[model samples]
Target: MKHRRLEVFLEFLFFGLVMGITEDLIALKFATGEPLTWKIILIVFLVALPFAIIGELIVDRVRWWRKIRRTFQKHVSSVKSSRK
Candidate 1:
């Protein structure tokens, strides 16, 4: 369980990092026409952190819910077929 949680966290962090960098690059291109700086990168990462965490949580929950639904459906189908 702990390992799975860590994996999820890392996955989310990577997702956030990629999103932040992309957005920062686009914004910089339009706003300042400047190359990436360490400061800008840090700022983007910081700003994206919360959004990433929230998105990760939501995604995890949805995945869990889907798994449960699939399991329930499979069980019900099995039972129905057995009865028939």
Candidate 2:
């Protein structure tokens, strides 16, 4: 259980970092003729953290849903086989 939680956390963090960097880059490109700076990058990274968590939660829920579906299908197939 702990391992699973850790995996989820890592996945979340990775997603967040990617998204944050992407966002920062896009924002920098469209800025009002301002030069990019380390401070701006840092700010974007910080903002991306929460968004990343949210993305992770969404992915995790989808993962759980798929697992449940697979388990259910397996159980149903097993019952049908035993009945024959």
Candidate 3:
């Protein structure tokens, strides 16, 4: 469970890094008044906004969700062994 949480966290970190660089490119192209790249970057960055929020929400919930999953797994394992 802890491992799963860590994995999720790492995924979010990677996503954030990618988005950050994309956003930077958007800013750079916009500042330079490049038409094609600017429009593409702008659209992508705008689309990424909702995903960023969802990522943050997932990151926030991972800890609690992991704990709950671990507890449930442990309980099930104990019950099975006891029955055997």
Q: Candidate 2 at residue 7, lDDT?
A: 86
Best by TM-score: 2
List RMSD in Å for every model shown: 6.2, 6.6, 9.8
Q: Estimated TM-score per prediction?
A: 0.54, 0.55, 0.42
- Any runs in candidate 1 off by more than 4 Å, and if so which? 63-84
For the record, the alpha-carbon RMSD of candidate 1 to the native fold, in angstroms, is 6.2
Expressed as tens digits, the lDDT of each residue in 1-84 for candidate 2 is 999988878977896789778877787778756777888778878888777777677755677889999999999999999999
Model 3 worst lDDT run, 10 consecutive residues: 35-44
Per-residue lDDT value at 14 in model 3: 65
lDDT of 1 by residue, 1-84 (tens): 999988878887787768877886788778998888888888887887777777677755778889899999999999999999
Strongest candidate by lDDT: 1
Better candidate number, 1 or 3, judged by TM-score? 1
Question: Which window of ten consecutive residues has the lowest lDDT sum in model 1?
Answer: 52-61
| Residue 80 of model 1, lDDT score | 98
